[model samples]
Target: MNFSEMKDQVINGVKWYFNRNWNRDDVMNMDEISDEVHSTLKMNTRIIISMLTAYSFGSSVGFIFNYLFKVEQRFVLRLLVGITIGTGNLLYQAITTKDRREIYTGCLKYCVVIVFSIITFFLLETDTTLRMIVIHSVLILFMGYLVIYSQEILYNADFGDIDYVNCTFNVFFHFPGIMIHATRLYLQGEQQEEN
Candidate 1:
């Protein structure tokens, strides 16, 4: 293909990736729709609670480490700590929950978090500001895609059957470390500029 044709194809591919929808269109009665909405609200509430719990736990750990060490270059250490805590939490849930589906869903959600964490780690390792910004933008887009895909999967399954709380907890458990890393980078940049 010609250069222009290849460029057009790449642009179209990106557009398609961002715009693709995975919504279900099954016709249902008003009662069924109301029931679905109610169940969704309940599940969302549980998920929000799980996310808050994870965030609080992760933030506490991160704050303790920061307070104790007073070190700026503890991204790897924090990542390891987050992973340990997240894994322990997941294992605890898996042991307590009798449902195999819940266990599998939690595992899948944890895997997704790990994958994104690794990607962010590498992307943020770049020293150039412009490059980092570009990479972060792309990362945001990919994360948005992940959110859409995850919602599609969750909505398609029986909401009550999945342990969405634990799954969401697993997904958000690493967020504190990521936030810390980003803040560290920003502070370092500021210091460099000031110097």
Candidate 2:
């Protein structure tokens, strides 16, 4: 195929992949939904409590690690640990729910994030301008993904509900830890330059 045709095929493939239809058993007609399903659909208070507790605990651990432990140098390790904890929680939920599609997506997300985090470690020692460019590139890619593929990422396939709570959970859980590490790295770099 010619170059333009090949590019079009690739773009169409990606669009189709992201928008692939799911075959969730939970999608039933209103008349087909069992009374048990309706009865069991009360508000889940435990989810709210657990999320708050997890975020609080994660933030406290981040504060302690930054201030108490004095383990300031290995920023990548902190980020890796944070991502691991958050992703582990997601995987656990996917498994407990027995949703194969979500399990697959969660695993994919974990792998991609882990690989990106490892790559970030190598960039730590690079020159300032190069580092900034890489960071900005990552930011742009993330924002673009959010803008273009938000529906796939944020919606629940089975329920057609906007189920992005875990994303907020991960952000609250991971961002602080990573930010603390980033701040320490910046300060250390400044001190070294002064010396």
Each candidate: what lDDT?
A: 0.46, 0.42
Clashes of 1: 0
Candidate 1 versus the native: TM-score?
Answer: 0.28
Model 2 backbone overlap count: 0
Estimate, for each residue in 63-98, the C-alpha lDDT of model 2 and write its tens digit: 565564343434525543544454455435433543
RMSD to truth, every model: 16.9, 18.6
Best by TM-score, which number?
1
**Which candidate gets the maximum lDDT versus the true structure?**
1
Off by over 4 Å in 1: 1-34, 45-128, 131-135, 156-159, 169-195
Q: Write model 1 residue lDDT over 2-57, tens digit each, in one string.
A: 99999999999755534422322221111232455345544553454456456645
Evaluated against the true structure, the overall lDDT of model 2 is 0.42
